[model samples]
Target: MFAENKLTEDFGDIRNFLLSEREKTLSEAEWRFRMRGYGYNLKRVDTGYEVARMTTQQVIGTLDL
Candidate 1:
């Protein structure tokens, strides 16, 4: 149950990050760099999803406290 909660929270954080970044005027490379810094990789999939799991390990780590 805890893992489920964590996943949900992570998804929310990811979505929020994407929305906020969309408002910025960043180049593709810069945007990917920023997302990587937050433990996410941005990609445009055929399903309309814009996030891709590029690394098995979280580069920026988790935010749990």
Candidate 2:
């Protein structure tokens, strides 16, 4: 397991990087806008990227159900 302090430090580093790359990074709203073109509703998953919702049926089908 990762230590809490280490995790905090890592998150701070990532935040700094994002701040430095703000102009290049896609905001949550922008990502959702792009995903809407593909008929997907995307939301920010974490401090990093966006994610789209998936159904249980899709997961099961993908698993060869």
Number of backbone collisions per candidate: 0, 0
lDDT of 1 by residue, 5-63 (tens): 25543655666565566557467677667666655665544544456555663232222
lDDT of model 1 at residue 17?
60
lDDT of 1 at 22: 52
Residue 25 displacement (Å), model 2? 5.3
**What lDDT, from 0 to 1, does candidate 1 have?**
0.52
How do the residues 1-65 of candidate 2 rate in per-residue lDDT, one tens digit apiece? 01222333243443343334444547746644644443334344344443232332121111110
RMSD of every prediction: 8.8, 13.2
Lowest-lDDT window of 10 residues in candidate 2? Answer: 56-65
Against the reference, the lDDT scores of all candidates come to: 0.52, 0.35
